[model samples]
Target: MTMNERIVQPQALLSLIALRDRALQAESLNALAFSMANDLYPVLHFHQALVFAQRGEALELLCVSGLSKPSEDSPYLVWLRRASRWVASQLPDQQPHWLARDAVEPPAEIAEGWAEWWPAGLWCVPLQRHDGQRLGLLLFLLEQPPAEGLQQALSGLWQTWAYCWAALTRQRRLRRWWPSRRQALLALAVAGALLLIPVRQTALAPAEIVSHQAQIISSPIDGVVERMQVRPNQPVEAGTPLFSLNETTLRSRAEVLSKEVAVADAELMAASQRAFDNPQSKGELTLLNGRALQRRAELAAVEAQLKRTQVLSPRAGVAVFSDPNDWLGKPVVTGERILLVADPAQPVMLIQLPVADAIALEPGAAVTLFLTAYPLQPLKGEILETSYQAKASDDGVVAYRLLASVEGKPEHARLGLHGTAKLYGERVLLGYYLLRRPLAALRAWTGW
Candidate 1:
């Protein structure tokens, strides 16, 4: 062996072992790359070091000596990448070698930037796994060539680094695939348990306050309403006149019948007086008398209809209806609902549950009402009854009507107070409770 090929000093050997230990102890590929580029300055005696790792079909610069992170867009780095690619292509044997500007002919672009960015001598080291797969490249710039013994030492040292690099790279790949497989499994188990939690099924619907035992007032006869005596929600006594219907037709009919009755009576009397002189007159007298009785009955019926034109309240309560103008001049049929005589103190909840939001509801189901007038102070009630058939509500949506009695007589609650009501049903899994509507919508859309 030549004199320059002698083994390194004991101190240098210790330093080499220490560097290998540090590289093996590195937690990540980045830490190892940092150590290879920066920590090797004291042992290798190089002016600058650039570390590159193989990424797919390209070489990616990982780090630079004395820089925590190298800017890939910098002019020097851009040029170095091109130079590294050219060097990587030339190294078919994947071995450590020395490079100089004049020793190897490079492409025109790489040759042009060599003098400005690099020194006279350059050492290229390709880091590879035991199976000969290229892992990374290390380019060390030197003002003077490294001794043959140090070169041999570096070759062995990098082999150890390649092994560590390959190990770290495999660990990094696993980390990218899944951060922690065990923790992910634990989270899935927790989520499954949470899905099984029991929760009560509930639905929201629009509700209103109405009287429990209210009297529905309807038209007694078919006539046009001429006037309304009491206003909406106005308090009144049992004998109070509620409204008056038009009496023009009834009065005219009564007057005509009265005149007809008088004429028939006069005919009957004249016939009776003539009956004494002629037999024909006596036969006409019976017909005249029957005609007079018929006219009188007709007049009595007309008078009775006239008395019915004036409507009166049957009970003492608040008159609940729309505006008085709605009734005035409007013709109504017999038994058509006009207003309601309801007791304000006996208030109950009326819920119009939409068909889409309807759930399994039973009598005496718990109901919580949030009144629009008194939103902060909610009222509690229980379902009394529910309509078996769905019908168009006042808002024009198909809904089922539900009646619920309030727990106590609340002074603040009155007729016509509207709000939202929450109805609770049987308990079910939390997953089912939350996914009920979504599942229903999905089924509707997919027809499944």
Candidate 2:
């Protein structure tokens, strides 16, 4: 009689025939589900409703209108469940449809007067498949009751919805597995790359390697370097003869002086005899005697000069030749230096300190040295002398010179074996380097 009656009246006859056709040749659910949700949105007063092809009871809530979900424990689900149970009982032989309180078959008074007299027109009818799966609910919330044609449409598509839900579940399972697998592979590749790379660093300290000042010796005398008595690096005691000059010229002069001395002795004897003979000749005799005596003294002076030909050592220790010893036959002039000897018992390490450290050091301050040749060994020494003034280096950096002594003949330690000595007068943690020092310097320089 009404539009609702027009939609629902033919459901019993039409649904039975449609079910048989679906059982015989079933299809995927997409078309049938779209028809249902599209038709239902207008009837239900809903803004949006998307049908999902998920198997079993995965969908949590049923909203007949807007986005409102009626909970499972609520009276709406109980009413829907009762209706579904009644429909499932007469399932194969009967068709599913919304029933009033006075249905001829299994009757359902569920959602009675839903839009007839109720304030909000809400009701739900559960749909089921022949295979005993809950296919979801047919939502019906409307301002007006459904047309009789609507029940025939709902009953027509249970089988198609079941097949589509199974497919969706399978796709969901696949999607969940892929992303984690991709991320795991990326992490493993990064770890492998890090392991293959290597790191290296310098083995030597930068500040420790530097050069200092030293001296060279030269020849001082005029005669030929007749012989070199000392070998290179050989130790010598103080006043030892390092080399000797030829004594030929001085020896000849001494022989002449000896003849003069003999003549003077005879002359002096004659003068004394004359004086004894004649008292009047005493003054002349005295003058002759004085001349002979003075001549004798000059002869003694010449003899002494001959003894100085042999060269003598000036100091005690090892000798380093300034030039090749093969040139020993070459002549040298007066005041020329032949060799030098130093104290072998104590050897010193010299370090050039930077301007800041140099200014801090004073004589008698303690220091320590560590040589590369004896890497694990440390030697103790003192600052015996410090340059009171600063000298600028070739790079324009100013520095002061420091000296430290090695304790013993260190194994593998030799003169000119390169090494370093730490001249520590202030205490600072080794970790604090550029930061603490540079900021302090900046502050001082800027007067900030």
- TM-score per prediction, in order, is 0.60, 0.40
How many pairs collide in each candidate, listed in order? Answer: 0, 24
Tell me, by lDDT, which candidate is best. Answer: 1
List ranges where model 1 is wrong by over 4 Å. 1-188, 281-286, 441-448
lDDT of each residue in 1-448, candidate 2, tens digit only: 6545644556544654554444334233443444545544433344334333213434433333333344667675556555444433432432333333333333327346232333343233445545655555544434444555654454444444444544444455666655477799998888666655543211111123211222234554356767777787777676776766677776787788778778877877776787887886777777777777877787777666555666566656677665646646777777766654545455676666776644255676666667777768766666677676667765576776566555556554455555666665544333333245676789999999
lDDT of 1: 0.89
Where in model 2 is the C-alpha error above 4 Å? 1-223, 236-241, 277-281, 312-316, 324-336, 351-357, 364-380, 387-401, 416-418, 427-448
**Shift in Å, residue 93, candidate 1:** 27
Give the C-alpha miss distance for residue 207 in model 2, angstroms: 13
lDDT, candidate 2, equals 0.53
lDDT of 1 by residue, 105-144 (tens): 9888998888887889788899988888899999899876
